[model samples]
Structure formats: structure tokens, C-alpha cells
Target chain A: MNLALVFDLLLALMLLWSAWRALAAPNATRAVVMFIVFGLFLTLAWGRLDAPDIALAEAAIGAGLTGALLLDAVRTLGESAGADAGGARSPWRWPVLAFSPLLAVILVVAVLEAPQQLVDLPAVVERNMGLSGVTHPVTAVLLNFRGYDTLLEVAVLLAALFGLLALAQGAASAATRESFLLHTLARLATPPMIVVAGYLLWAGAHQPGGAFQAAAVLAAAAVLLHLAGLLPAWVAPGRLLRLGLAGGLLVFLAVAILPLAHAPLLTYPPAWAGALILLVETALTVSLGLVLAGLFLFLSGRSLRDEETR
Target chain B: MRVAPVLRRTLAFALLWWVLVEGSSVSWGIGLASVGLATFASLRLWPPAHWRISYAGVAAFAGWFLLESAKGAVQVAALAFQRRPDLAPRIIEISLALPAGAATVLIVNVLNLLPGTMCTDVEGKILRVHVLDGRLPVVEEVRAAEARIARMLGVTQ
Candidate 1:
């Protein structure tokens, strides 16, 4: 039919193919690689659904960071789902195959039955958006209307960081030397990446990007550096690292509770709403970056210890 | 010559913020605060005195690298479209004259990006690259790529 329909069909087919292959791929590396592709296709599908925000998150967090994590895990573990995994089939394949058709029918029915139009939320957000912090309706909803949800989302990231730290038991010596290629690329890329992260964070106020996307990009760069032996996790100072990791949740909680004078939680004064949200987003971005990067560090088979002789 | 990498980074961060905020100076205060904190954290983790890059060398290397990679992409794309593709893929190990530094790292990555070649591993001065066309003199190509990077980085043997 139309271009969009063709694009959606292609995306759906690719998603299905990749998902199937990612599950049944011969080796761990191939499986994880296909899984990454699957996630990327899912991101595109999200875009097709007209959810730019979800699409961005899916691309950065779902596809990008998750791929890096899986790759790192495979590297560290030195294998994937199975030993001598080639041509291995899942034990429950027959049962899964039998149920898949029914599940697909149910899913198709649900999709067909679901309402195509939302309940004028965008119109409402547009009208009262002046009082809300930012220009973007998504940002307004996240930072102003459903601020609690965003706060909890950030807290979950912080908690994950702590969980990773608690689980990692050993620390290896930091690699001081980086290869010429990695060192130069990291050097040049760092400047542009910094700029991009900043731009993404700022643009989230009026567009698709937000703290989560910016933080994910930052974390990816950190992972790349870590992998290259350019910036090891062990070099981070304990107190400062702890503070940066928890800073988002702390700032959000503080900001949330401070506005008791206002009618509702996180309802900032219209004049200062934009500035306040910006401050919170900045904190969230930093903490999320550190937390996500910390998780990658843990996955790298090196626990970030409190003290290290850098 | 002396350099303050930290300060330079902080200034770069400011420029980044300027572009991020769409050239608006209204949020300079927030920008300054965030830049200070990020710069401090970045400096502590990645201190100065690590890298000293030559702008001209980097510029020249970028130009050449871009051209080479484009050529490589075209070659690979053409191969993909062919009815009968010669995929004599095999891994080859070569020694890098440039030490295990920036030049070597870039060479490995660039080689990985190049058409029909993938650098699987790099240890010290030795690099293991897998090429699609094993018949081709990929070793020479890799060696030449390394030499070009070495010249750019001024990493003398």
C-alpha cells in the first residue's frame, strides 16, 4: 500500500526473523549478535508506532547498551548459552512451536481491537503545557504530570548499580596502556560525544531525547573506553563515585518533597519550572551514566573496588 | 609547551552545552555548573598528560581513512551484489611496527572497519586480522594502513 505500511511490514518480518535466529543460533556470539539486531528492529517498530520517545530509548538502551553488555558478558564468560552450542535445539521447542500460533492469533486480535486514537492527552498537555516545565509533551508528562514515575525509574537505575556492585567480588589491575587506534578514536570521539550527550539532554526538553538516552550514549562511550583499556573502572574514587551514582535519586527526592507549598508534588512555579526540570534532568543524566557504566564495568569481570593504585 | 587538559576539556564542554541548548545563553548558569562537575569527574578518571595529538596529522589521517573506508565499503557492497562471491575468509596475524599505543589501536579499528577485513585481536605489536579475500595481499594492505597511521601519530618504530 503506502510507504509506511511497507516499512512496517519489513520491520515486522525482520523482527520475527531475528528473534527466531537469536533464539536458535548455533553459537553464543551469533545469538547475542542477532539479539542485538532484534532489539534494533524493535526500536524501528516502536518508531512505526509513532512513539519517538520509546523508539529512542529502545535504540539506545534496548539495542545499544544491551548489545554492549551481552558482548562483554560473552567475552568475559568466554562462551554463550551452551558449550559446543552448534546445532543445539531447545528442549521445549516443540511445545513452544505448538503454542506460538495461538499466541500470534491473540496478539493480532489485540492489535486489531486496540483503539487507534488516544484520549486527547496531547491537546490537554498542549493547553496546560505553559505551567509544565518543558515544551515537549512527553517531557511535561514525565517531569510534571507523572514525575513520580520518572523519579522511580531513575531510582531503579541507581538500585541496579548498587546491585551490580554488591555482586562483583574481584578487582583486576587497571590497564594503563591503550592501543594507538583506540586511544586516538576515544580522544577524538570524546569531544563530539560530550557535545551529543549535551545536545540530547537539552533537546529532550522539546523533542524525543531525554536524560535516559543521553546517559545511555555516555555509558556506551564509557564501555568502549573500558574495553579499550583507556578508562578502567577501578580508577574511580569511591566516595565521589557513590555520590554520583545516587545523586539522581537524592536530587529527585529532594525536589519532589521541597514543593509542599504547591498543590501537587513536583508542581513547580511556572516561571521556574523549566529551569528546575533542567536541573533534575542534568542530575539524572549524570547518575544514569555512572550507573549504567558501572554495570558494564561489573560485567567486564572487574569489580570496581573502593581503593586502587592508579 | 604546557597544557591544561582539564581546563581545555571544561571549555569544550561549554561549547557542547552551547550547541545543545540551541545557542541560547539563558541556561549558561546550569551549563557552567554541570560542566564543572562533569569536568572534575572526567579529570579525576582521565587526567592530563596522557595524549598529545597533532592536528595536522589527525586531519590528514581522517581524510585518508575516510577515503579508504569508502573504497572498502564500495568493494564489499559490490561483492555482496555479485552472483558468485569469493569468500575465502581466513584469519592472518601480522606484526605492527608501531608500538601498542594510539597508532596501533587506530590501525586495528580501521582495519576492522575496512572492507573484507576484520581485526579479531590485538596484543602488543601483533594483530590478528581476518580477511574475506584470502587471495588478495591483505597483509600488505594492513601493513600500509599501519604505516600511514604510524606516520600520522609520529610513532617511530
Candidate 2:
């Protein structure tokens, strides 16, 4: 095999090995760490596949954000049960074991037997690139060609935030004590992060970034804010908070539906495509940032609340 | 909390935008607005407070910290590959003389990068640190870093 092919094989094998270790690790913490490593490997694989967008998402969301979430869970749960205490339970049981191989076989067959030429949609999308509001094919597809899917994704993020808020309200909030170190780090990092997010939002029109990756980075920064105790003890489900949760979806819907009576749903006039897409992506980034960070706050809230109740 | 740092930070962000956008003016109009919001939010969240940062001192401190941390990192790498690491890890506690702002926490955070130490928890002036090698003069290094950070923040003594 060529070097590139050999590299891909090794990466695939390593990914599989890590996946197994992540699932089969004796305790939750080790498994969680392994899973994060697996995410890093998967990101590399995606990069090798010439999908920088998915690589960024995989690293930022799949590994970084998800790792933080799992670590929070483990830390909170472990303290109560004792670190080693009942953490050895496998997420998989008999049903997963019995059904997974068949699922795997079906997936492998689907990959092997798949037609080389599935659809001419990519060619069509390329031809329509000039008419598309954005230059990036992924963005064109996500925001225009399949705008409906993105709208639903925004709604799902908002729903997750709201659901977490409901769960966190009854629980005690994480205390935000004044700490100099975290405060400084967050402050020093925030301005640059904001600029980067904005650039990503704009570059997404022609590059590998967009709302999702930018939001993930912003979410990480917000988590840093929380860690620094900059956030309030717990966010009250105030009017502003609720609006922030649904703001992206509302903006998307408004943009999508307001003109629908004149034309089909989400069919932006050719001239206004770029502006409209930018508007939607900006709103999407903010709301996504809030929702993702809200998840993080609630996760830490559980830990802080657990400590107090104990 | 002075206006100077705020202005400086805003200007710094503008420079960052240059790098991020690769000097493309096409979207600077929108990017500047985001930068403004971020600058405001950042200052609001963590004001200068009592920090009176000296640029020269900060530069010097940063240089030293980076150099020391590189050494620490190398040592840790070697230690990790050892078949049997001579174990002397311990939780050593130290109380800060610096004020209650980010000075203590900032130093603690830096200690995490300084090879063997992980700043575990802090309660007021007291710090509970986990150093990977108790034999190393990690405490001295921490004290040195803290002193430099305090000076950088214009904390007297």
C-alpha cells in the first residue's frame, strides 16, 4: 500500500482499538479519557479524508466539549460513589453485544457495495455556486440547499438547553467565587476568541468554518467563564434567557417563513442569498453558543449541587 | 480596571482580527462589531480590578515562565518514560501573601504547566497543590512564578 493508504489503515485500526478501550475500560474516568483520544484520532481521519470542516467539528465538539461534559459527570458521580465504586458497569449489555455485529456487517456491506456514482447533486450544487449565497459548498448545502435541516438542528440545541435548564432549576447552582487566575485567563482569551469566531463566521462562506465550530469555541470560552466563577450562581429562566435559547431558531424561521408566502419556504431571492445566510448564521452562532454553554453550566451545576447536598 | 488596558485589549483584538481575516477588509465591517461586543463582555466579566500590569515586567515574567515550563515539560516527559518513576508525590499546602484577586489562582494555574505541580484546590489564602515529584523544588518555583505574576499585576510585595 502507498504511505497515505497505510496511514489511513493505521488510523482506522487505532480508532477501532480506542473505541474498544473506551467502552471496555474498567472505570468511567479512564473510558472517558480514551473516548476523547478516540475523538482526536477520528478528527485526523476526517482530515485525511479531505473534510477539514468535520475535523474541526470532531475535535471541538466531539472531543473537547464532550470530554468536558463526561469529565463533569464522572467527577460529580465519582465523588458520591467513591472514584472506583460502581463505575465499572459497561454501557453495553447483552442486547448491544448481540446486535452490534450484525449492524457492523450491514454497515460494512453498505460501504463495500455502494455505487461509485450515487447522485449528481454535487455537480448541480457546483453549477449553482454563483447563485448560492455562500461560496463554500458545505455552507451552501447547510444554509441554503438544506436550510430546513439546519433550522431543526438549531431548534434541537435550544430544546437541549431548555431541558437542561428545567433539570438544573431544582438543583443548587454552581457557586461563582472570585478567583484571580481564571478571571485573567478568560479576560485575556475572550477578545481574541470573539474575533476568531467572527472570522470563522465570515470565512465559513468560503472556507471550512461556520456556525457550529465557532459556537463550540465560544461555548468552551463560556465554560472557562463558569470555571472562573464569572457566571452567575445559576441562570434564572428569565425572559432574556428564554429568548437567548430560541433566538437562532426564531431568526431562522422568521427569515425562512416571512417571505415564504411570496415564494417557496426558505427560497431566498437570488440577490439576497448572501445577506440572508449571514444573518441566519450569525444568529445561529450566538444561540448555539448559549445553548452549548448552558449544557456545560448545568453539568457543573450538578457537581456543585452534589457537593452541597452531601 | 483602568481605561488604558481596556483600550489596549481592544486594539489587540483588532490586530488579532487582522491575522484571522488575513487582512481581508471585506468582512472587517462585521468583524469589528463582534470584536467590540467581545471586548465589552470581556471587560465586564473580568475588569482590571486591582491589577496594574506593567508591560516590561509581564514580558520578562512570560519569558521566564515559558523557559522554565519548557524545562519542566522535558523533565516530565523523561519521567513518564521511566520504567519505575521514583515516587515522591505529595499534596503540599501554601498560603498566599498576595491579595484575593486572580493572583493566587493565576499562579496556581501556571503551576499546572510547571512540570510536576497541579494546583488542586484553593480556599482563600491556602492552596492545596499536588506536585508529581516532591523531591523537586516545585514550591520554590511556584513562589518565584507567584512573585513575578504579582509584580506583573503591579501587586506590591
Candidate 3:
């Protein structure tokens, strides 16, 4: 086999191993760490599949954000009780082992049977591209042709955030201070990360980095800053923050409402179309990041600062 | 002082409402009127000063919290399927960090929504919680929650 194919197989195996470890690890923290590794590997797999955008998103939102949230939850649960108390020794270990492998084999077989390549690229994507008004195929699909789906996805995210916020309303916030190591890491990483995130955002117009990927990176930087105690949680969001959150939705609504302006809905002014699309995507990245982060913090019921008492 | 805070909060809420509801075809007059009405209604319910938010801190905390939540979901799912029972210790207490306000109320509600845990009570900062698998270590969890609250209120470390 070629080196690339061999590399792909190796990465896939690693991902499977990490996923299994993450699921079965005795320690919750270890499991979270393993999942993060699994996410990184999944990104590599996506790269192999020539879907860099998906890879970037999987790394940022799927693995990174998800891992952090899980660790935080574990920490929250740990605080209430000195240790986990509801665990029970199992007698069905052997049965699980036997069944799991069979399930994995079947899944592999199913994947193998699926179509190996795209049969009609130009007809499907090219034909529909005009309706989207965006040059990027994925963007056109996500924001134009499948606009409703994208809107619903945002709504789902918002709902998840609100739901979680409501559930953790009364919990005492955690008091751990940012460690020196964390602070150092943030200082070293923030600048490059921000630049990279911006590049990703701008590149999305024509390439793999889009608002989602860009926003996730920026959010990661924000998370680092918060963790290191550089950014205080109680500082009220400014007008800019509000604008950023609503910007994407506004752009979308404007396009949807434009049909009344002597054109079809989402039909843009010829000269401003490209610029507007970029603007909308940028706004979307920021909004998504903010919304996701807000839900997490709101659910934890904690502020950014350290509490005075132990 | 109370009136001013209330006004500020109302304005914030109104702005958020306007951004969410206004469209390209919306008339300038309608947008303004809607914003005004929403602001007035919000102020009537809770007053302005009572609507507190640590926007900067929350923004930061949100990122970390999301990551943590996803991790939690996976861990809980795994525990559910695991064949071993590993019960550790269980304890309950009221949360002290959250203030006596809407923010605190929101926090308690979130605890119940997340998997592998449930909220028992919330008098002050002492919080009572029930975990799915109790054999794991949890001091860090409590500490993380406390930190999140501190961040929310803009308290300095």
C-alpha cells in the first residue's frame, strides 16, 4: 500500500483505540483526555478524506470544547461527593467483550459496501451553486441551499445552551485558581492562535477554514484566557459583544427578507455580495463561539473570578 | 442607583431583542417601537439593576464549560455501559458562591439538565447533588464550579 494509505490506516486504528480507552477508562479525567486525543485523530482522518473543514470543526468543537466541558462536569460532580459512590462491579464483562467486536466488524462491513466515489460532482454542486450565492461549495450548501437546516442547527445550539443553563442554576461555583502553568501557556499561545483563527475565518471564503472553524479557535483562546484568570467573568458584555452575537442572524434575515426589495430572498446586491457573505460568515463564527461558551458557563453557574472563601 | 442599573439592564435586553427580531424589510419605526416596548416590559418584570451579567467572564467560561459538558456526556454514556460498579463516596451541601438572584436560579436549573447528576437544593452557595457513578474523585469538580461562579460575578482571584 502507498504511504498515505498506510498512514490513514494507522490513524484510524489510533482513533479507535483512543475512543475505546476514553469509554472504558476507570478514571473520568483520563477518559476525557483520551477523548480529546480521539478528536485530534479524527481531524487527521478528515484531512485524509479531503474534508479539512470538517476536520477543523471536529478538532475544535467536537474534541476540544466537548472535552473541556466534560472535565468541568466531572469536577462539579466530584465536589459534591468526596468520591464517586454509585459504581457497581459488573459480571457481564465477558459478554460485552464478545458482542462489541462483532458490532465493530458489522459496522466496518457496512462502510465497505457504501459507494466509494462521487459520480456527479459538477451537476450536483455546480448547478446548485448559483442559488447559494456563495463561491465555497460547503458554505453554499450550509448557508444557502440548506439554509433552513443551518438555521435549525443554530436554534438547537441555543436551546441546548438555555436548557443546560436552567439545570445548573443553583450549584455553587468552583473556586480553583488558574495554575501558573496554565497562565504561561495562555501567554505563549494567544497571539499565534488569534492570528491562525483569523486566517481560518478569512480563508473560508475559498478554502477549508470558515466561520465555524475560525470561531472555535478564537473561542479556544478565550477559554484559555478565562482559565488563566486573565479575563474576569463579571465584566458585562459591551455593545460590541451584543452586536457580534446577533450579526450573523441579522445578515441571514436581511437576505431572507430581500425578496421584497425587487429580487428573490437571499439575492444580494451584485457588487456587495461577496463582501456581505464574508461578513455574515465572520459574524456567525463569533456568535456560535459566544453562544456555545455562554451555555457552558451558565450551566456551571460560575463566574470567571476566583471566590474568596474555600 | 437602582433605577439606573435597571435602565441599563433593560437597554441591554432590548438591544438583544431588536437584533434577534428585526429583519431587512422591517420599518425603522417598527423596530424602534418594538425595542422600546420590550425594554419597558423587561424593566417591569425585574427592574434594570437586577439584570446582572459578567459578559467578559461568561464569554470565557462558556468556551471551557462547553468542552467540559461534551466530555461529561461521553463519560456518563460510557459508565452506563460499563460492566463494573465503582461506587466511591457521596456527600451533599448548599452552594455558597451563587448570589441570591436570577443568575443563581439559572445555575441550579442547569445542574439538573446535564447528565450524570441532579440538584437537590440551593440555599446560598451550598448545593446538593446526586451523581450516577460515585467512585471517582470529585474535589476538582466542586472547585471548578466555584471558579465558574467567581468568574460570572467578575470577582478577582
Q: Point out where model 3 deviates above 4 Å.
A: A62-64, A79-106, A115-123, A127-134, A171-176, A184-188, A234-244, A260-272, A300-310, B1-157
Model 2, residue pairs in steric clash? A180-B101, A180-B102, A181-B102, A181-B106, B1-B48
Give candidate 1 misplaced runs (Cα > 4 Å). A26-29, A71-100, A115-118, A159-191, A230-238, A299-310, B4-26, B29-100, B107-157
Q: Interface root mean square deviation of every model, in Å?
A: 3.7, 2.2, 16.3
Task: State residue B34's C-alpha deviation in candidate 3, in Å.
Answer: 33
- The alpha-carbon deviation from the true structure for residue B90 of candidate 3, after best TM-score superposition, in angstroms, is 41
> In candidate 3, residue B156 scores what lDDT?
37
lDDT of 2 at A18: 96
Q: Please give the distance, in angstroms, between residue A58's alpha carbon in candidate 1 and its true position after superposition.
A: 2.0
lDDT for model 3, on a 0 to 1 scale? 0.63
Flag regions of model 2 displaced more than 4 Å: A71-103, A160-169, A176-184, A233-236, A296-310, B50-52, B73-100, B109-151
Best-to-worst TM-score order: 2, 1, 3
Candidate ranking (DockQ, best to worst) = 2, 1, 3
Q: List the candidate numbers ranked by lDDT, top first.
A: 2, 1, 3
List the per-model TM-score of the A chain: 0.87, 0.88, 0.79
Could you tell which candidate, 1 or 2, scores higher by DockQ? 2
lDDT (10s digit) by residue, model 3, range B1-157: 3567656644664455444333233223323443454445344433444334688878877786787678778877786687984444365564455555544555554555444556666545567777665654444565566567667765532
- For model 1, residues A90-118, the per-residue Cα lDDT tens digits are 67767887899999999999999999676
Per-residue lDDT tens digits for candidate 2, residues A1-310, read 5998899999999999999888667777888889999999999998999999899778778754788778877876773442443334656566687899999999999999998887798899999888888899999999998989988888777777777767664454555675566567776776677777787788899999999988888887777666667665345657896687688889999999978788989989889999999899888888898788778876565644565677
Q: Tell me how many clashing residue pairs each candidate has.
A: 8, 5, 93
